[model samples]
Target: MALPVAMLGPTVAQAQGWPTAANPDEVFLYPEESEDPVLLYPDDNSSSAPSSTPPLPNSPNIQPTSVRSLQLIGGEVLTEAIAQAFYRTQLGRPADPARLERIAFAIDQWYLDNGYSLSQVSGWMIDAEGVLTVEVVEPEVNQITIRYIDNEGRALDDEGNPIEGRTRERFLRRELQLQSGAVFNQNDVIQDIQSLMALEIFENATVAVDVDEESRETPVVDVVYNLQERLSRSFQASGGVSTELGLFAGVTYRDGNFNGRGESLRFGTQVGSRGLVFSTEFTSPYRDSRPERLGYTIRAFRRTGRSVTFSDEVRLANGDDARERHFGGGGSVMRPIGDWDAELGLNYSRVSIRDDSGDLAPTDELGNDLTLDDSGIDDLLTLEFAVTQDQRVNPSNPNDGSVLTLSTEQSIPVGNGNIVMNRLRADYAEYVPVNLFNTGRRQNPEVVAFNVQAGTVLGDLPPYEAFDLGGGNSVRGYGRGDVGSGRRFFLATAEYRFPVTGPLGAVLFTDFASDLGSGSEVPGDPAGVRDKPGTGLGYGAGLRIGSPLGLIRADFGVNDQGDNQFFFGFGQRF
Candidate 1:
C-alpha cells in the first residue's frame, strides 16, 4: 500500500520525489531529472484549444503567475547593496562592497597566518531576485611557520638566543607592543611595529602578510627583525636649593650590566646646609629571576639645627649652636608578598649631639655664663620591618591617589645601659582633588596643606628625649627647639603654592601644633610635672626662582609672638 500525498510531503520534499514503500523500479536511491514540464493549478476555468494544441502544463502560452525565474551562478554575488546593508547595522553607515571584501580578505589572511589553513566563506542565494547570505567557516589550525632572523642572522639556540622563540603570530597577537583585539586595524599593527622598533632592541623589524588566492585559506606572514645590543650605563645629576636646606646636589650612576649578568649598581650624594650627606646603594634584581631584589645602603651626614621644642617659654640661655653628626648603614631584602611589598633590614646608627649646656638647672641657677660640653654619642642598632602599599596614578606626577607606609623599629644598645627604644611610626600622604574654588592656583599663594604625623617613643628616657613638635617644619609659628618632651604631637598646616611665571613660584604656609609632654623630668628635676603646653600659629610667604642649580628660595615668616625671621634655601618646602 502507498502512503497518501499529505503523509509523504516531508520525505518527498527532501528526496524530490522518492517513495517510502515502493516497488523495485520505484525504490531508486537517487532520482533522475524529469523531462516533463511543471504543472500548476489555475484559479479560474479556461477553454481548451483545438486538437493540435498542447496540454495546459506544456503550453507556452499558459504562463504561471506564481512561478518566478531563478538563476544559479557559479560564484557568490556579494553586491555593494548587500554589503552596505549588512555593515550599516553595526557601523551606522553604508559600506562599499569593494572595501568590505578587502576587509574580509584581510581577516581571512589573519586567520590563516595563525594556522587556520582551511578557513573559507560560503554564500547562498536567499531570494531568486535579490537577497544573498554569506557564512564564514573557520577550520582548526594545522600548522604555523615563522621566518625570522636574529641579531647576527645566525641560527639561535633555545637557551642562548633572545629571539629563539619569537614567531610572527606571537608578535602579531601576543608580543606586539600595542593593545590587542582591535578588530584587524591595520594602523594598530603599524603602530605596534613602530613601538617595537622604538624599544631599540631591534635594528629593524618589518612585518607583512600574504594569502593564497586560490584557496583563500592558508596565509604566510613574513617577519624580519635585526637586533642590536644597547649600551648598559647611564648617569644623572640634579641640584636644587631651599631656605631650610641650602645648595642640595644629587648625582646618580648606574651600571645596567654588571658582570654581564644584568645587575644594577647606584650611588648618589646630596649636600646642603641642613646636611652634607652621601649615600651608596647596590641592587641585584634577578637574584632568582622572579624580580626579587637585594640591596644595601650606607649614608653619612652632618646637619646643624637646634632641637625641636614645644615649650611656650623661650629660655634665654638655650644653646643656639647645636648640630648633629649621623652615620648609618643598612641592608635590606625586598620581595613581593601578595599585593603588598615587604622589606626587612638591619641598621646601625651613631647620633652625636653637640650642645653647650650640659643639663637643665633651676630657675634661680640659670646663668648666661654657663656653657657645658654636653656632646655625647648614642649608638643604636635597629631591626626594622616595613610594609608599603602603593597605588598611585602617574607616580612621576603623583597628583592623585594615596600611599601608606607602616614601619616598626627596635633600638638595642650594645655598650651602654640595657635600654631599648621601641618605636612605631606610620605615615600616610593622600592627594585629594580640591574643588575648583579651593585650588591653590586660583587663590593666594599663601595657603598650605594640612599634614598629620604621629609617633611614639616607648622606652625610658628624660622628658627631653621624647618627641617635640615646635619648629619650622613642625609648628611654623613657634621657634626652633622650643617645644619639648612629649610622646605625641598633632599638627595641621595649610599651604598655598602659585607660579609667578618663568620658573618663579611662591608659597604661603601656616601651621598649628600642640604638645603632650611626658610630665617627667630629668635626674635633676624630680617634680615629674608636665611642662606648660603652648599653641602656635604662623604664616609666611616665600619666593622661588628656578635656575640651573635648582630652585633658590627666600622666605620671611612671622609667628604669633611678632617674631619675624628670614630663611634662605632651595627647593619646595614639602
Candidate 2:
C-alpha cells in the first residue's frame, strides 16, 4: 500500500488501485512490494536458500551396514578418539565402498556442524583394504568485496566513475555479514539475505561466492550481494467512505527509499462530509545495517469537521452541524521488542470546539463550550506509549492468527491548555479458520473472528475530546455517542466470514458495547439531553470486496432501537 494518509486510500467502489487508509494520528504500514505491485501486501516470511553448500549425496547401503576399517587422512584436529567417537557403529562390522563414502561424508558433515563451514572433504573416499581416506580443506577469507549492477545493469569497479545502484555501497558493505581474514561461514550468507530483504528496498537479494585458486595455501573466498531493486517512489489516489467521516476522496504520495538511504517520506489529504483532513510523515531507521533496527517518525496534520457527539451519517434536518477543528505535529520513536513493536510519542495540538449554543454550553463549563466561536483554543500536549503484536497470516486480510495492541496517553495542561486527562485503550482481534462450506467458494477458508476493545479516561476531559462509541465503527444500530461518549467504554464483536466468490466475502456479525454506566464529564447534562443509553447492542451483515486499493465493505445493521441503516467503510472494523 502506498498510502501515507489515513482514511484516504482506495475503496471498493474506486478500486482502480490504491493503498489502505490509516488514522491520521496513527503510524500506518506503508507496504513496499517486491514481487507484486498490486493484489499483494508483503510476504513477511518469504524464504531464501538456507546455505551456500549444495546438498551432499545420500549415503548408499554398504553390505555390513558399518565400516570395519576406516582410514582418516590430513586433518589438523582429527584424533583416534575423535574417529572412534563418530564411527563407533561402523568399527564393529565389515565395510564396503558405500560404507567408505558414508564415512567420508560423515566426517565432512562433522566439521561443518562444528562451525568449520569452509572445511571440505574430497569425494575420493574408498581406498585399498576397505579403508576410508578423507582430506579436509579449511579455507580462510582473504578479502571481502561487493559486486553490484548500476541502474543500467552495468557492473562497476569499486572506484569506477559511474557507480552501481542508487543505494550507497557503504550501506551494503555495512550489511554484509562476511569479514576478511576470517573463516568463511556459509550460514552468514543466509543471514545476509534476510538482512537485505528486511530493508524493503530490494525485489530480491542473493549471495555468490568465488574461491581464489591462487591463494591455495589457505584459499580465500570473495563474496558478492546481487540485489534487484523495487520501485522506490509511488503516487496514489482514491475515494472511499470512512464510516466515521462518510464519503470522501483523497490522494497520497510516498518515497520508500529516499536519498538512497532507507528513509521514507509521505503526504496525503482527503475531503469528506466530516471535513478536510491531511497528514505528512517522515521516518528513518536508526541504523539500516544492524539486525536490531530502531526507528523514528515525525508527523503533522490538520483536521476539521469531526464530531464527538451523535452526528448521524445523514445531514441534520436543522441545517446545523457542529464539528471540531484541530492541527498538530508529533513524533514517535519505535523499537521492536521481540515479537512486539513499541512506540513512544509526544504531540502538541490546538483544538477549537465551537457550538453556536454558546449560552447553552460554555468552554471549560461543558468541556469549554468547544471553542466554537474560536474564543479559546484547547491546548493539548500529549505523551503516548503503545505496543502491538501482530501474528496474522496476512495482515491485510487474515484467514487465521491474532493481533493485540495496548496504549496509554497522558495529556498535560500546558500553555493555557487547562484540560488534563489520562487515557488508556486496548484492542485485540483473533481469526480462526473453519471451512464450513462443502462447496460454493464459501470454503475459501471461512473464518470466525472475535474482537474486543476497551478504553478509559481519567481527569477532566474537554467536551470536544470524547471517546464516543456506537456508529458504523462500533455498535451498529446506534449513532455516534448514542451509547454515551464517556470516561470508560468496552466493546466486543463476533463474526463469521465466508468467501462468496473471487475477491468477495460475506460476514454476519454482532456487536455489544457499554459506557460502564459513566457518561462524558461535561459540565452540562448533554448525556441526559441526548438520551444516552450507557449501553448498546447491534446485529448486522456485511459484504467485503478485496482490491488492490484495499478491502471495501457495505453493511446493513439494526441498533437496539430497531433503527436500520446501511453503512459503507474501508478496511475491517477491527
Candidate 3:
C-alpha cells in the first residue's frame, strides 16, 4: 500500500519576461525574475505518471482467480454503477490483478477529471467473501502554517518544527484564502503561492503536505509553506553602449521590501557623452493590508541630451545646435479588477530644445529650414488610463498563454507650453509552446511568440513624445532614434525561441513597422535631414542568458536596406 498523489516539493529556478525599460536610449531597468513550474514528482505517489502497462484483457501475464462480486471503497465520488461500467465485461470471467489495476486507473482518472488532484487510489485487497475491494483516499486539509527562510536556507527546531518567519502570518493568509476544512486543490494552492512570491519579499515559496496521523480523522493532511525571503536592500551597477548615447553607465539602489510592508523605493542615474539622466520611483502595494485595490506608485525623472542629425548635404552630422532638456514627474494608482489590472495616473513634463548657435540650424544644403516648429519650451499635463491582462505561464519567461495591454493619454491645455493632444496605444502578445521531441525534453517548452503594437496621436503633438520605432526594445537593425518618429505607427513581430543549454536560450525574430504615411508629420524630416521611408522591415537572431542581473540579451539584425546593427541590453524585448 502507498500514499495518495503526494507531491514532495517543487524545485525553483529563475527565468525572464515582463515590462522593461520603455526607452532604448536608457540603459537598464532591473527586472523581476520568474520561477520554473514544478517538475513531475519522483518515483513516488504521483498520479500524473503514465501507466506502466497496457490496458486489461490484452495483458500477456494474468492468472485469473475465482472471486465473488467486486467492490469499490473510500472517496465521496464514484458510484457502484460507475464501477460496474468500468469492468462490465470482466464480470463474466474470473478476477485477475490486471483487471483490478485497470479498474483502479479508471477511478484515479475520474478523481482528476473532477479537480481533486490530491486524491487517488491508496491500495487494493481481497476479502474473505472472495470479494475484491479497491480503496480511494481523498485527503482533506487539516491545518496550514508557514515558516520564514533566510539566506542560509530554511531553519527548523530539533523536533523538525518550522521556525517562525519575519513576515506576518496575516499577510500570507489573505493571499491564500484557503480553509482548514476544505478539500486540497493543488491548482488553487499553486496560484496562491505565486501571489506570495509576487510580494517581492520572498525569493521563493514552496508547499509540502504531510499525513496527519494523530488526527486519526478522515484522511487529514497538514500543509506547510516554506518561504525564503530575499535581501530587502540592495545595490546594482550596470553599463551599456548605444550608438547615440555612446558608452554610458549607471548605478541603482533599491529597497524591495521597505518597512517590512512590501513597499519599494528605487533611485538611479545614467550619464554618457550625449546625455545625463536621473530618476527616482516608489511603489506601495497593500500587501500587509488588503489586495491591490489600494496600491499606488510615484516616479520622477530628468533627461537632458543632444541630437545627431544630417546636415545640408543630407550627410550624417553630429551637431551641438539642437540641445534638448526634459523634466517630468508622475504618479499612478493600480487596482486588480477580476482578471485584469487597471491603472490611472497623471504626468507633468516640461520639454525644450535650444540652438547653441542661432547660425547653426540643422538645414539641408538646399537652404530649407530643417528645424521643426515650436522648438521652444513646452509643458504637458497628461492624464492616462490603462488596463492589462497577463496570462503567461511564467510572466517573466513565458512558454505559453497571452497578454494584452491597452492605454490612452489626454493632455489638458493649461501651462505656458499649453499642449493639446490625445494618444491611444495597444499591445497584444501570444505564445505557443512547442516540443519537437515530445517524449523527453526540458521542463519548459520551446515557444513561438507573436506580438502587435499600434498607436496614434491626435492634436498638437511634439516630436519628443511621438512614436519612434527603432531600438533594442523596438525595431532592430536600426540604432535608437535612427528610425523616424511620427504621429502614427504600427509594429508587429514574430519570434521562435528554444533552449540551447541551461540558462542560455536563442531566438530568431522578424519585425516590421509602418509609419502609416505620417512621414510628412515627422518633424525635422521634410528637408531630407533623416530618411523616413514610411515602412521598415528587420530580421534578426539573439541570445538570452539568465544571470544574477536577470536576462542579458544580445541581438544582430539586418534591415531591408541591407543595413546591419547589433544590440546589447538587459531584460526581454517585450
Candidate 4:
C-alpha cells in the first residue's frame, strides 16, 4: 500500500475534454472486410483477412429481348383446383361427364320441339388441362307432318271412304289443341289429350312419334293419331243451398246429339222453405251457336210464410193465422245485345189468400167486420224484361269480380179494373279488398257488399190488394207480416267474411229495413196502414265449413229488441 504513486496509476484510458460521438460506419464494420489481425480468415495471405471473392456489384443483368421464355407455370396448376372447387360448391357434388351429357340432350330436345329440328351441342377438351368449352348450334326447320286415323284403321273423309285431303296434314296440325313452333312439354301433350277426350267425341285417343335415324342432321318426325266416335246421351244430378232457401237438390238429363241434330231439353225442381219450384226448358242448338241463343222455360211455383199484424200497439194476434199461395207460368226469349244480355217474357199468375179467425171478431175502420166463407183469388198478367252481365266466377262462391243485374216487372189488368202494379228491382254486389295486416292463414277478407231491394203497389186497393215483406228470407230483422203498405219499402244488408282455419270461414252480417205508407193521417185500415213507422236493425254471424255436401253453414243473429234467432243453411247469403 505504500508503493510509489507513478507506478500505481490507472491502466484504463480516461475521458478527455469535449468527449465526441461514435462514428456509426466504424462501429458496424464488416468482419470479412476488416484489416485487423483478429478478424482474419484462414485462406487470407495477409495477417488481416480479406473476403475470398470480391462482392458482386448490386446491378441487374441485362439480356437481349428475344432470349427469355415467357412461360406460365402456377396458373395452370391452380386453374384445375379452381374448376373442381366450382363443381363441388355450385353443383353440390362432383360433376359427371354422363350427367352433363344428359343435360345437353334435354336442352337439345327442347330446341327441336320449338321448330328447331337441327339442334346440337358440341364439347371440346382444351389441351387436357381439365378445361371444357361448349358450343350450341341451331338449324332451321323444314316442315311438320301430322297423320290422322280412325278407330277401325281407316283414313276416311266426309264420305266414309279411304281418302286424304290435299292439305290434310296442314289442316290437322292447325286444328291441334297444342300449337306447333311452341316448346314441347310432355305434360302439355297429356293435357291436350285429356281435353280432346273431354269433348265427348272421342272414346280412344293415341299419339305416336317416329324419327329418321339415317339423316341425323335433318331430323324428321312422324305423328299419328287414332280416335273413336262417341255416344250421345248423358244425365247429371247437382244440389246445394242458399241463405234464402235451406237445402235443395235438382236432376238434369241432356241428349247431346238429339236426333243427330243437336237439341236439348231440361226439367228441374227445387223444394225448400221457398216452396216448390218446377221448371221445364228446351233449346235448339242450331239456332245461332255463337252469340245469339233462343230458349224457352216454363216455370211454376208456390210459396208460403207466416203473417204478422201491425197495430197502434205491438201485439201478437191469437187464433187462426193467414196464408197465401201463388201459381205462375212464363216463357222467355233471350238474345245477346252488345256487352249485355236482354230477355223478354210474358208471365201469368194467380194468387189466393185465406184468413181463419177462430173466436176473434174481424174488425174494420168503421167497427164493421165481415166473415168470409171462402178465400179470395186475384189473377194478374205481367210483362217482364231484364238485362244483365254477370262476370262472377261461380254464383255460389264469388271470388274474382262483381255482378250487376237490372230487372223491371209491370203488371196490368185486362179485366174491368183500373188497377196497376209496378215493381223495379236492382241488385249490385261488389268485392273490395281489405287492407288487413297479419291476416294469418287467410289471404284476404272483409268483403264490403250490400243488397238493395224495393217493392211498391201503384193503384187503388180493391179490398184484396196486398204488399207484404218479412219472414226468414225477406227481412231477417222483422217478423213476417210486420211490414205491409200501399206505398214503398226497402231492405238493405251488408256482410263481411273472416277466415278461421283451413276451409272454414266466418261471416258477420247486418240488415236494415223500413216500411212507408201513402196517407199522412193514420188510416184505420187493418191490412193497409200502420199507426207507427216500421223500422228494424239486426246483426248476426255465421260459420262456413267445407264438407262433402259443399259448404255447411250455421248462423245466429239478434234483432234490436234482443230477439235471438239462428239460421242453419249452406252456400252464400246473396
Candidate 5:
C-alpha cells in the first residue's frame, strides 16, 4: 500500500505540469556515492622500448631531526656529513622518533634520486648500545661502456667500439659528462644524452644502466651509452620569394662531421633575379689538440636594382640602381674562454660598381657631382677583432638566453684611394619567457625577444661600404635597401612568440631604425654624406614552421607609410 501511494504521487505531480527540463547544476551527490579517485604517474620509461624497472617511490618532505651518535653502515658511498645534509638532520641532541624515521627514509630516497634506484635502507633501529644504526644499500658504478649502435658503413669495429682508424674517440668522449668509476648520477646521464644528440653526427643517443651479476656483493652497475650515427654527407636545396629579393633558389652541401672529427665543410650558391652569390666555408673546431676554432670563407657576388643612397630626390633622378661586383675571402681564428669566444680575422675584397645605364661621374646622394680621382674599383683589406657570447639553447629557435657580439673593422686602402674607413658594429639579443596561465612546467610556452644593432663608419666611406637599413633583413616593411643608406645607423626589433602546436609557432614583431647623415654635403668632402630621409617603422606578424631543413618563416608587415610587404626566410629574423 505504501509503494502504491508513492508511485501515485509521482504520477500526480507529472499531471500537474511539474515536470520540465532538468538542470544539471541542481544535481548533487554524496561523497559515499562517488568512486575513488585514481592516481597517475608520468611515464619516465621509454615508449619505444619495454618499460624500465618499476618507478621509484617519491621522497616525502620531512622535518628536521636532532639525533645523537647517528651511524650509517654503508659509509663508503657517502661521507657522514653529506648523508646528513640530504636529510637536513643534526647530531648531539634529543631526537624525535618520528623525525628520525623520516631522516632515515630520506637518506634512502637520496640514493634512489641519484640513480641508485635499487638501493635502500634495510634497517633503521636504535640498538642496545645506545646508537642509531641506519643500514644503507648504496650501489657504486664499476664501469662505463660506450656503445655505438646502428652505425654502419665501416664506421665501427667488430667489438661495437668506434673503429680507431675511422673514428676519433675524443669527438664522442668530450661530450660525456659521466666517467668510469664515478657514482651514477641521473642528472649527468640526462645531460650526457643531450650533449651527444647535439652533435650533428649522431641522430639518436640513449643510456642504460645495468647491475653487474659477477660483482653482487659490491653491487656495481655499468653505465652504457648507445648512439646511432647519421649519414656523413647531406645536401639541401630551397627556393623562396620575398618582397625584396623577388625570387631566388639556393643549394648547399655539407660534410659536418668529416672523418668522425668535428670538422665542417660547406659550399652553397644562390641565384636570384637581383643578385647571384657563391660561397664556400670550412671550419675546424679544435685545431692541433688546442681548444681554438679556425675557419675560412670565400665569396663572390654581384647585385643590381638596389639603391644605397640617403636622398629621395637624388634617388628619383639617378634611379639609384647600380650594378656592383664583389669578390672577397676571409679567415678567422677564435679562442674559447669559458663560454665566450674572442676572435681575430682578416678580409680582402675587390669591389667595382657602375651605374645601371652607364659609368657616370661620382656624385653624392645630394647630387653634387665630383671626380673620385679614379674608377669605382677599390681593393680593400680589413682587420677585424670580435668577441661573441652565445648562450641560446637552440640556434634556429630560441626560447631563452641571450647573444651579444661586438666587432670592429679597419679598412685599409690597397688598390684605389676609395677604401679608407674604420667601422664598428655591436649587436645584442635576449629572450624572455612568458607564461600567463601559470602552467606548472619548467619550459615556457611563449617568449618575448628583443634585438638591437648599431653600426658606424668614421672615416672616408664609399657608397658600396655604406650601411643599408631596410628590406627583410632589416626594417622589414620595405624593399631591399629602401631605407636610409648612411655611414651610421641604429636598428631595434622586438618580438613576441607563442606556440600554436608541435613545431608550429607565431610571432608579433616591430622594428625601428634611423640613420645619421645630412643630405646637404659637399661631394668631394671626405665626410660627404646625405641625410637619412626619416626614421623607419615596421610592424608585423609571422608564422614559424619547423621542418627538417630548418624553420620556415613568413611575415606580413606594414610600414609607417602604409606600405605592405612580405618576407620569407629560413630562421629567426635576429
Candidate 6:
C-alpha cells in the first residue's frame, strides 16, 4: 500500500490573479490547482477534505454550519493573541468550508512573516465535543551555512583563496543572526542579510531558504548565506588643506575583518604645515555578548600656531608664538538600553605647551604674570560618560530621523596643583524629508537638517581643550578656529539638501555661534572667565557629490567678520 502525501500549494484563486477579496485564495491554500476551486475554512461545523480516506470510524461527525466553539492542536508556536484574532474573525459567522482554509492561510502567513518558512497548516478535523482541531507542522532550522561566491560563480574569497568554503563558514558563523535549531523567522533572515551587507568586508550578501522533504511529516530547513566578499584590507593615501591646520597629507591602513572576526582596526598618520598627528583605533561590535561594544583609540599630536588672547579686546599679545603637544589613549565600553546607549571611558594624557616668542610672559595659577621659565607640563587622568540616542534612518546621510548625544568628561591632575577641569557637552540633529516637485518618487527627496551643539568647562583647562568653533565642520562662514577658543560656546546650524541628478546634489546652510568666556584665561584663576562673548554668523551654499569613497562636500561661505572662505571635505557635516 502507498502512503498518503498531501501538500498545501498555491491556491487556484490566486493563480487566476484575482484580488484578495474576489479570489478568496488570498487567505487560503489548496492541495491542487483548478480552474474553479471551492473555498475552505477550518471550523467546528465544516467538513474539510482529508489528505487520505483513512478509516474515521471513531471520529465524530459535525455539521457544515456555524461553529459555536473552536480549538487548536499542534499550535505551540501560536500565541493567545493570534488565537483570539482568528477566533473573532470566525465566531457567530456562518461556517463555510472556505472559511476554514482562509484561517489556515492566515496562520501560514503569520508563520512565514515570523521566519517559520517550513511550517504549514496541513488539515483539520472536528472532535466529539464539537471543537475544531487544526493540524499544523512547524519545522525548525537544522543548520545555518555560509558560502562565498564570486562573479564567475566560483567559490572563492576576495584574495582568490579556494578554501573560502571553510574560511567563509568560520568568518560568518559568529555574525549569523540566527543559530541552528532555532525556529525559523523571516525577520531574522532579512536582518542577517542586512548585517552582512553593512559590513565593509562584503560587497553583497544573499540568503536562500532550503527545505528537506524526505520527512514529509516533519520537515527541517537549512538557511544558506552567499556573500561576495570585498577586500579585507586596504591602504589609502589622501591630502587635504584646512584653514587651521594648513595643507596636510596622510596614509591610512584598514582591516575590516581582523582575526577572522567582525572586528576592525585602523592606523593612520598625517603631516601638515602646522601639525603632525598619528593615531590607531580598534573596535569590536560585541564583547563576549550581544548589545555590548568595545573600542580603543590612541593618538599623539603636535601643532604650532599663533593664538589670539582676549581681555577687553582680542589681540596677539606677548608670548603669542605657541606650540602644543599631546599624547593620549583611551578605551570605551558601551551597552544598549532601549533606543539609547550608555558608555564609560577612561584616558591618560600628557600635554606640553611652549611660547617661542620672548615678549609673551606666562601666567601663574593666581592669574599673576610669571617669567617665561615658569612654564610647566600638565599630566591628566580623565574619566568620561555619555548617553546617546540615534534613530536616524541613515548614519551617513539621514533623510528622516533624530539623534541626541550628551557627554561629560572630568580631567583630574596626575600631580598636585596641575590643571583639572570638568567639561559637559550636548549635540542634537534632526532630519526632515520634503518633496519639492512631488514627482511621486520618495527616494532621494529633499531634506532639511538642523543641528545644535554646546559645550562648557568648569575649573581650569588648557586653551587647546577650550571650545573652538568655526570652519567646515563648525560655523562655515568663518576661517577654522577664528570664531573663539573660549571656556564655553554654543553653535547652531541649518542645512537644506535638494537633489540635482543621479548622485549630485546642492545644499544651502547657515550657522551661528557665540563664546561666553575670554580665550586667554589660565587655570585656577581667581578672576574667573568673562561672560557674554561676541557672536559669529555664517551662511553659504555648497555642492554635494556622492562617490564610492563617500560624499564629497564643497562650500563657499561668508562670515559676519567680512571673511569669505571656500571649504572642501568628505561626509555630512554632522
Q: lDDT values of the candidates?
A: 0.43, 0.64, 0.65, 0.45, 0.60, 0.62
Positional deviation of residue 408's Cα in model 3 after best superposition, in angstroms: 0.8
Name every residue pair that clashes in candidate 3: 16-396, 16-397, 17-396, 312-364, 312-365
Residues 1-574 of candidate 4 have per-residue lDDT tens digits of: 1111121111100111111211222231121333321211233233322111111243223222121111112122123343233223214233333333333333333333333333334331212223333334332222334444554556686697753322224323433544444322234344455544433334445655343434665343333455543344566676787332456676656554344433445566666554455555554421222343464445555543323433333222432343444466777777766676677788876654433321222333344221121224556678888887766533445544677778877777753332366666666677544545334232224455566766555543433333445544445545554544334567777777666776787778887666665322112344434443356677888887755344567777677777766677756666
Residue-level error in angstroms, candidate 1, position 426? 2.2
lDDT of 6 by residue, 1-574 (tens): 1111111122311332312232332234322332212234344344443222111245454466556676665565775555556655555555545555555655665555455545666666565444666666666778776777774556765687862621345556666667777765666776676566545466556766666758655767677677766555779898998543568998989876777665777888888785667777787653323434454434333333443222222222342433444567778776766667778888876555444432333452234432212454556778999989977754556778899999999986665236578999999999988887553122234888999998888986665566766778888877666676667778999998888777788889999987755455533221233322246899989988866455788999999877889999976787
Q: Which 10-residue window of candidate 2 scores lowest in summed lDDT?
A: 1-10
TM-score of each: 0.46, 0.60, 0.68, 0.47, 0.66, 0.69
Q: What is the overall TM-score of model 4 with all chains considered together?
A: 0.47
Q: What is the per-residue lDDT of model 5 for residues 1-574, given as tens digits with 9 covering 90 to 100? A: 0111122222322332322212232222221232211111132121322121221244223224335566677665556776555433335555444445434444443454455444555555554444556666555666666666563434467786764323477767666777776655566676776666545456446666665646366566677676766555779898897333458998988886766776777788778775566777777653323444354433343333334443333442356444455567878776765667677878877665545443543554455433333665667789898888977654346777899999999987677665677989999999887875443121223888999999888776665566777778788787665666666789999998877776677889999887655212223322233333546899999998865555688999899888979999977897
- Candidate 2 local lDDT, residue 39: 16
Using alpha carbons, what is the TM-score of model 1?
0.46
The weakest ten consecutive residues by lDDT in model 6 span 1-10
Higher-TM-score candidate among 2 and 4?
2
Q: For candidate 3, lDDT tens digit of each residue in 1-574?
A: 1222234221110011111111232221111111211111243243433332233232334346555676777646556666555555455467655445534554554555455565666666554455656566667778887777654565665578866665667756877855687776666676777688667577557777666645575677777777877556779898898443557998989887676666889899987675667889999874433663578999999865554333113431343445555689999998877888889999998766544332233333344333334335677889999999978765666778999999999998876556788999999999998876452122234888999999999987665576777767777887665555667889999988877776788889998887787756745553124565657788999998866445678999988889979999865677
Error of 2 at 284 (Å): 3.9
lDDT score for candidate 6 against the true structure: 0.62
Report how far off residue 355 is in candidate 3 (Å).
5.9
TM-score of 5: 0.66
Superposed Cα deviation of residue 84, candidate 5 (Å): 9.4
Better of 2 and 6 by lDDT: 2
Each candidate's number of clashing pairs is 25, 14, 5, 0, 4, 17
Predicted model with the maximum lDDT:
3
Best by TM-score: 6
> RMSD in angstroms, candidate 4?
28.8
